[model samples]
Target: MDGEPRTNPDVPRVDDVETWTHSGLQAFLQALFFVLIVRPFVLLFLGLRIRDRGRIPAGRRPFILIANHSSHLDTACLLNLFPIRRLRHLRPVAAADYFERNPFVSKLTRTLFHILPIDRTARRKDASGQTGADPRQRMLAALQAGQSLILFPEGTRGNANEVTRFRSGIAWLAQAMPEVPIVPIYLANLGRALPKGHFVPIPLFVEVRVGEPLLPRGDREEIRAALESAVKKLKDTP
Candidate 1:
């Protein structure tokens, strides 16, 4: 609770239990089964390599993980590299338009992993003419409910090593939930292994670097600048 409350606040409170129980036991079991039994083999077959994973924080506090987007592989790389203890509590903020389009994919995303639908184009009117929920509000609600979120502040994939301008939405979230730590992560060689528009990933050594958690200290711009700096440092490291 850092910033002023919104006029139409949809964010859940810090101690809200409804959000915590949204996904029931079936979801948890499915996620456990996939992560422990299925995902390891798939990652091994893909020749994925994760390094510098010790940087991931060990405690359980709501966190915002901001990373530079390079390819779809970024998600898998980060997921695999995260500490197993934290994996159960992590939720990736995926685009509503993309992942929710298909029923099977949507169910799998929600059940196998805690995937939240973030409307990137929240201001745009849907086919039915109703506006979508504010992305920042949705993200805040997730954080308030004691869940960690992974977001690509760039909004989409871009060239490897190229950090796009950090979006202001991340700044808003940081300010809104100052208690939650903002973690900076970097993925190396993912763009080369599976660049934009390529369906198949080339077998290559992938590297992941997790930087220190960032705390908000100043205004929105200052916090965003700090977050951007941390992410850039991870991207710059060899």
Candidate 2:
């Protein structure tokens, strides 16, 4: 069924909407200080470099920026390269299991960044028991609200800079929000800077190239293949 609503049995429904109330400015300031001030210093000290930042469009629109995930630093590196004015409208779709593991990270992700929780495991059924909270639905809702999202289609980080096969969720999202552009991003040298295990990033020059926006066409499988191919081409670029 197209545009059908699905509920995940595992996702606990909150009785009150107030439970999701956002944090105040003071709280945001404190969080921003750490994210903007301390984090950048560390990254800079590690000789982090970003290239092709001009490719990212500077405007307000419901869009999705898809990239290859390589390390924990992926999100931070993207945020660092993202335009400052556009930050407020962009939300990153993060894994619930990883981000929600700690209270502080969860609050920061939910309040400051407006991240949406995605279920990685396919076993959990949605409220209708048909499908879980499809990441595409969340992306559509964000788009309908005139907000943008950041997604890593590979699902997880790999060892090399090569692009992994994209999951079908991205295709589904593109199909649902045909008007929204899907921006492909390539972050070079991130894998070596900070691989999967290492918490601390070594001094390494990183390049982020934002390619042309992708519009959906054909079936879900076809779109998925296109998105994967686009990402691979972005990675291949010098």
Q: Which run of 10 residues does model 1 get worst, by summed lDDT?
A: 1-10
Estimate the lDDT of model 1.
0.72
Best by lDDT: 1
Please state every model's RMSD to the true fold in angstroms.
6.1, 5.1
Cα lDDT computed for each candidate against the true fold: 0.72, 0.71
lDDT of 1 at 150: 90
lDDT (0-100) at residue 135 of candidate 2?
Answer: 54
> lDDT tens string, model 2, 1-238?
3346544333433322233333466346535754776456646665556556666767776778899988877776676665455565667788977887767787667765556666675334454365555555655666676777889998888875578789888888888878888889887888888899888867777777788887879999999999888888888877
Question: How many steric clashes does model 1 contain?
Answer: 0
Candidate 1 per-residue lDDT, tens place, 67-103, comes to 8899887776666656555566777888867877677
User: Against the hidden reference, what TM-scores do the models get?
Assistant: 0.81, 0.81
